[model samples]
Target: MEPSEHARLDAYWRKIASEFAPDPTARPSSLLVTHLLPERPAFVRAVGAVSELRAVLPKPKSVVAAARREVEQSYRVDELTRERFSDPDDAVAYLESRAAGERIILLDVGGYFAPTLNELCTRFSGTVLGVVEDTENGHKRYASGEKLPCPVISVARSPLKDPEDFLVGQSVVFSAEALVRGRGDILHGRSAYVLGFGKLGSSIARLLHAKGVHVTVYDKDPVRRAQAMAQGFGVARDRDQALSAAGLVLCATGSLSLRGEDFPTLRNSAYVATVTSSEDELELSGLPAGYSRSAVGEHITRYETTGHYFYLLNGGEAVNFLHGASVGPFIFLVQAEIIAAARTFTRAELSPGMHEVPAADRSTIAAHWLNYWNR
Candidate 1:
């Protein structure tokens, strides 16, 4: 870590040591059903240590073959499950069958299985206290104008956007560089359109502009659009026109912002990718796509549309994540946020609506993360 990063972390960890030292044995005994990527085994073990982890339902989209192996080798969680399954539905069913009289708690990522979430709340009823989802896209399902059956806690909108900016911004730029590594200068003089002007989008735009690429940013929220304009980025006054003229279209919105209807508005050569959706089902499944594996070998799948050819890099997964760079070293802090959010979700006296992670918990985690980051 840099000297500044070390100093920042030292302050946080010092507070953590003074305030909240961990105790593995004092965890509450509760049934845990999780659906997430397998990249973070430390996350699995941490949550398991705090609960009776019954099953680890690894979502296939994010949990690549190597991730499955990592789960096996690194997840030494003895307090919960020992089996792994490909199907999230089976995991849900198993949890349902065992839900006759149990206190169930869900630890989810990307909220890939909304049907599963609905099922758990339906089958378990009052027994399931709440669920914690770490992705904005997943939280959107519950936060939408639909009736929810159980309590939900979302860690996606955590106030700690600075660290997230560090993780996601660097990851996207790194991946983009990787994509153009052997291709001989594809990024320099190209126009790129980024959807959403939030932390990730803004950072990506700044980085691409620094590379002399023409960058335009679009956002649904007026405040966000204004923010983009203030940052001196091209604010897309006309979405269709901006998208169609771009050399690249990066979806950082984390919502279902891009769809089949929207694809007609993009250039045939535009390299498209999404950032926040953790599953094919949540974000990519709805796109009107007809793609096949590219013989060109970069995992660049080719799609035929608009009487021309467009491409979906990494099979419509997050571009940054496609090259094995999703949540990097800063995940320790993110997991800390999730841990605090999950614990707060259970005990906080909030209503049945969406809520941020408690301020106190956020402060505590930030402090702890500072300590960890310094080291």
Candidate 2:
């Protein structure tokens, strides 16, 4: 079925159809995705799913492989015409080689590194219009003064709806539940330390607190710390204070907040997980040398840190997207936000600066989501 026809039944699809305006300055036939998206099927199928989730994207196998190949086998990769890159530099090099009139839509999760984005903004400027950023790390860069080419959109924390609050709530329930699955009442009376009192951290702290765990929130920002304290969640007085006797340490801050120096204080059997969009949120570099490591199956990694066992789900990537299968559908809902944001770049006269999903478009996504879910 044509994309328009599918839009008839799905409000989300309809919104995508209406929000996506073709670029007036360039053609948009090609696409490139990358490591920024580790195992996200929603992004891999974003373009094609505008027709509906099940629609087979007529694009070649190369299109699906633009990022990770985990989802490629499940999608239609009928051709090998488009370029795919596991290395960010290779993708950058490809952009540098593009001639005028060869612009294609670029969907990336991590083009935020100054040097990488600089290459695209200068050497490969105008080679593409759709530079969709789907993570908090990427959003932070847009807030930076560096200018890239035209057409950029971010769905991580859009001003329009900013569903991070809702998404994080769901993520906590699922990720926390995963940590306790078949493991007895680990959270019933344990001390839970959550780094970053941002949307995700607050939610995790709230849920954990409700579960009878002592929730302590650690955020470098004073305002956020006050918010956590006001919410009845314990605020970490200091960095080391946050890890003191923490039975469960969860990192929600997108920064390298959890590191090796903090490990010595992480109590034995203290479970550590990252619930942020960026993997570096829990800096593995902080793990002390000579720590034993093993895979505990189901994408969980067990590490002996400071003479205690620490379980890092999905290699400290986003736990909700990995071991928390129950959290899957909700993240997909956030993907609707992503699709809406990307659609904005297609038509809006945007600049190199970071941008959010417009209010009108954000409302469309929320409405369509409610309609689709019958909520």
Candidate 3:
């Protein structure tokens, strides 16, 4: 007997799901471990499900091999640099070749550098500058710490372009792309106020305005405020002017004050979300001091209390850390663009204050990722 249309559709959906679904029954992939420390070995394997977790222990050497593979495959040295580096020494040599005439600015913290590797990287970089320390709201990671032999600058308390000697790459560039080119209309035509006018906030405003959203931007800095006005944005002189007349409020300033009281002046129907950092927990407003809350996390909280739906992201964390990573191809495209910029600019001069990744490189990365995805 022929299956019904609904049955066929169900089967098709199930088949699609099976392709991407985590395989519980399949044996876990082998472990590769490498422990630089003699006493401790590094472990490598994607862990998921109970059975997968039970797989054998990792050996340090194997981890070393896996890390090398990650560096090579992810960096695509064969295509980008036209040569392959098999070992750490070779990789160091390759980086040296690239850095022979360039200045390298590294943000060191979070155990990102080991004492030995730190010495090695310093030696490898022709001109190495040290970051001061990671700060509460900015590129402190890139600047914070003991300054290296070369010129060191603090990203937290300085504009990037002031000391234009090196290039910055190797991170997400959502703000730049979203601002200059606009983005998918997640909140179009909504009365919106954006707090913060740095890279992320500026990008959000640019995209929101393109979608016809009336954007009132509030930044404490007069210079940034003027820049917003120059871009045809409604510049709010203070929080009152910003929060007073809006249905949606977006915090991209990396401000941690997205609590309910911050927007006390907002209309009762106004909703709030963030694109800077991911919020871990969400709480509803307008109820008793303590009300039932949603157990949602990882940014993307939708609340329906007063007959209107309000959304909050990661409690209000960086949007990219939540929804952005899920769109792997989108990120790959961005990274590829950055990589191309790294390749091109390795041959040129770089200006400061977080330079925008070049457009041609962005195009190349986007095209490569798109083609790869289609394939």
Q: TM-score for each prediction?
A: 0.79, 0.74, 0.42
Off by over 4 Å in 3: 1-129, 132-136, 140-186, 257-260, 278-288, 295-299, 302-310, 325-375
Q: Write the residue-wise lDDT of candidate 1 on 1-375 in tens digits.
A: 367754554454344333432344433323433334443554565665555565566644445565456656744222222222234556456666544556656666655445555656565533666767777666776677376666777777777745666578767867766675534547766688888777777878888888888889999899999988888888999988888898787877767667666665667667776665424322445556553335343756666644776666666666676665555446656566656655654454556656666778777776666656555
Write model 3 residue lDDT over 1-375, tens digit each, in one string.
135633433333333223223334422221111121111111111111111221122221112343445433322222211122224465456546544534443332111222223443455655433222222243432233354333222223223221111111111224222322232334554687877776656766766676677889888789999999999898876677567677777765543535554444556546565543332112234223432335343334545444344445445444343222233223233222222322333334443323344455445444443444555
Ranking of predictions according to lDDT: 1, 2, 3
Regions of model 1 farther than 4 Å from truth: 1-39, 64-67, 73-92, 98-100, 116-119, 277-293, 305-307
lDDT of each: 0.62, 0.58, 0.40
The runs of at least 3 residues in candidate 2 whose Cα sits more than 4 Å from the true structure, single-residue gaps closed, are: 1-11, 23-89, 96-101, 110-115, 144-151, 159-165, 294-302, 305-309, 323-334
Poorest stretch of ten by lDDT in candidate 3: 162-171
Tens-digit per-residue lDDT, 189-304, candidate 2 = 67888888777677778777777778888888999999888889877787786686787778877667677677666776677777654335765776678788898656566787
